[model samples]
Target: MTSHKRWGLFFFLAPVVLWLFVMIVLPHIDLLVMSFRFENDEGQMQWSLNNYLAFFEEPIYWLTFVRTAIYSILVTFLTFVIALPLAFYITKVVNPKYQGFLLVLLLLPFWVSELVRVYGWMILLRESGVINHFLLKAGILRQPIEMLYRDSTMILGLVYTSMLFMVVPIVSVLDSLDNSLIEAAYDLGANMWTILFKIIIPHASPGIMSGSIVVFMLTLGNYLTPNLMGGKNSLWFTEQIYNQFIASFNWNQGSAFGFLLLVLSSIVVWLGLKLTRQNLKKVVQ
Candidate 1:
C-alpha cells in the first residue's frame, strides 16, 4: 500500500498489460472492423454483413463450424475422463516419494513441441509406421492398416496434447484433499464408489471446471494436431478460416468466421459454467 510498493506493482504489471493490449486487443479490434466491411461494385470499401452471412448461406462453412464445436466438446470430455483417474492416482495412490517423478514423467513428452508429439503419433500410426510394421513382422496382420487421417486419430492427438492441462489442474485440487475425509466416509460404511462420488468429486469440482474450460478452448482453437493427424479429411472450421485467409486470401470472410468461432465458443463456455454451477472467479482461483 506504500508508494514504493505501488511503484513496484505497477512496474511488474505494466509490461503484461501493454503486451496484451498491443498484441491481442488491437488486432481483435481491427479484425472486428474488417469482418463487417467489403469492397463495393465501385471498388470502394463499405461496411456490410455479407462476410458473416456467407457462413449461414454456405453449407460447408456452417457444417464445418458445427463439426468443430462438437469435436472440441468430445475431446474435452475425453480428456477429462482420461485425466481424472490419472490425477487421483498421482495424488492419492502414488507413493509420496515417487509422485514428483511420476509427474515429471507425465511432463517429459511435452517438453518437446506439440508438433513433434503429433509427428511421433504419425510415426506410430501411419500405414508403414512402427505399429503396423511390428504387427506385420510378428505375423499378426496381413498388411499395414490405414490408421491415419481418421477422426479417432485426430481426437487422440487432441486428447494427448490437452492431457497435461487437465491433469495438472485436477492434481492441484486433489492434492489438497484430506485422507481423513475418505477414512470418515469409510467408517460410516461408504464404499469406494460412494466416497469418490460424494467427497472426491465435489471437492475437485472447481479444478474439473477449470481444466475443462482450458481444454475446451485449446482444442476448439487448435489447428496443428487436427490438421496433421486428420489430414485432408479433418473438415475443421479452423481449416475453413485458414482457407479463407491464406488460400483464398479473403481476409473479410476469414475475420467473420474467426469472430463467429470466438462468439460461439464463448457461449458454450458460459453454458458449461452455468450447467456446472461454476464461475469465472472460482475457475481462475
Candidate 2:
C-alpha cells in the first residue's frame, strides 16, 4: 500500500487500537506489577512472592476455584442440552412466524438486567413464593420447600443466563443447514435419534463448540447469581476476588487471583479449540 493509504488505515483503526491498549493492556500490566508487591514493616510496598504464597497456602481460594469450575461446567452442559433442542425445534420444526415469536421470547429476559433475573429467582425460591404457594395449594407438599441459596439455585441461574448464548449460535448454524439432508436420512430408514446423533449434531458441532466456550467463560466469571441465589453459603471464586479487591482493599492479592483465573480460562479455551479442531476464522467470518 502507498504511504497515504497506510496513513488512512491507521487513522481508521487508531481509536479502537488506542482504547484496547489503554483499557486492557495497561490494566493487565499494572496488575502484574502489583501482584509481585507486598506491604513492608513501614507500610511501604516491596517486591516479594508473599501474595502468591498466601494464595497457595490458603484452602479457601482453591476450594472456591474448584467450585466455580464445577459450577461453570454444569451450567455449560445444561445450557447446551436445553439450547440444542430448542434451536433444532425452532429452525427445523417450528413455523417461520412462530419461530420469530419464540426467538423474541428467548431474548425477552435479556431486556431485563441479570441482577433483576436473580432477584426474580429469589422470589420464586423463597418460602412464600409462587412455586411453594402453588405446590401447597395443589397438595404436593405440607409446607414450602427450600430451593434458593443452594448450589442447585446457582446452577439454575447460571444455566438460564448462559442458555441464550448457546441458542443463538446453534440456531444460526442450524438455520443454514439443508433440511433435505435430514429428510433424506429419514427416508433411508433412519430414526429420529440416529439422524440427530449421527448427522444433525455433527454438522452443527462448530456452533455447539463456540456456544460452549462462550457460556463456560461467562459462567466462570459470574458472581451475582451465586451470591444472590446462594446466599451466605455460596463463597464463589469471583466473590473471593471481589472481597479481596473491593471489600478488604487487598489489591495485590486480588490481582494475583484475577490473573490466575485468566490463565485457567485461557487454558480451557485452548483445550476447547483443540478438541473441536475448529478453524476460528470460519466462525468469525
Candidate 3:
C-alpha cells in the first residue's frame, strides 16, 4: 500500500478505536475498581468483596438475577420464533415489488421512541384501556380486565421492541439464499420439513445466532419496558441495579451487580455458540 492509502486507513480506523477505548474500556475499568471497594463502619473506603458477597447473601438479589436470566431467555426465544416465519415470508413469499413496503410496515412502529411504544401498550392493556373498553361496550365482558403489570405483558413488550433486530438479520440471510437450492432439494423428494431442517436452517444458522444474541442482550439489559409494563411487580435485575445506584445510593453494590450481569451475559452467549456450533466471526458477518 502507498503511504497516502495507509494514512487514509489509519484515519478511518482511529475514531472507532478511540471511541471504544474512551467510552467502553475506561468506564468498565472504573466500575471494576468500584465493585471491589466499600465504605466501612468508620466511613473509610476499603477494598473488599463485600459488594459481591451481599448479592449471594441476599435472597432477593440472587433470585431476581436468576429470574431476569430466565425471562431474557424466554424473550429471545419468542423473538426468534416470531421473526423467523415473518422473515421467510418477506424474503420468499412476498412479491419483490411489495417486499420493501411490507418491511417498512414492520419498521413503522420502531420509528417511535421505545418509551412511546411502551406507553402505547399501557394504553391498550391497562384497566379501562382500549381493549377492555371495546370489549365492555361490545358486551363481551362484565368488567375491565386487569391486563397490565404482569409477566406476560412485560415479555410482550420486550418481544415487540426487539422484533426488528431479529427480523432484519434473518431476512438478510434468507434473501442471499439461491432459489435453485430449494428446487434441488424438492426434486430429490425432500418435504418442506426435511428441506427446512437439512438445507434452509443450516444456511441461516449464522443469522439466527446473530439475531438471538442481539435480542437476548437487549432484553436482559432493558429497564423501561419492565418498569412501565410490569410496575412494581417486575423483579428484573436491572431494577436492582437502578435501586442500588439511584434509590439507595450504593454505587459499590450496583457496580457488583453490573459486573455480574456482564459475566452472566457472556456465559450465556458462550453456551449458545457452543450448542449451536457457530463461529462468532461468521455469525457477525
- RMSD (Cα, Å) for all candidates, in order, is 1.3, 1.7, 1.2
- lDDT for 121 in candidate 1 is 98
Between 1 and 2, whose lDDT is larger?
Answer: 1
Q: What are the per-residue Cα lDDT tens digits for candidate 3 across 101-196? A: 999999999889999999999999999799999999999999889999999999999999999999999999999989899999999999999999
Error of 2 at 243 (Å): 0.8
Question: Which whole-number lDDT from 0 to 100 does residue 111 have in model 1?
Answer: 93
lDDT tens digits, residue span 126-245, model 2: 888989999999999997888887888888888988989999999999998899999999999999999999889889988898898899989899888888988889878899899999
Candidates in order have lDDT scores of 0.95, 0.89, 0.95
* RMSD of model 2 against the true structure: 1.7
Error of 1 at 98 (Å): 0.4
In model 1, the clashing pairs are none
Backbone clashes, candidate 1: 0
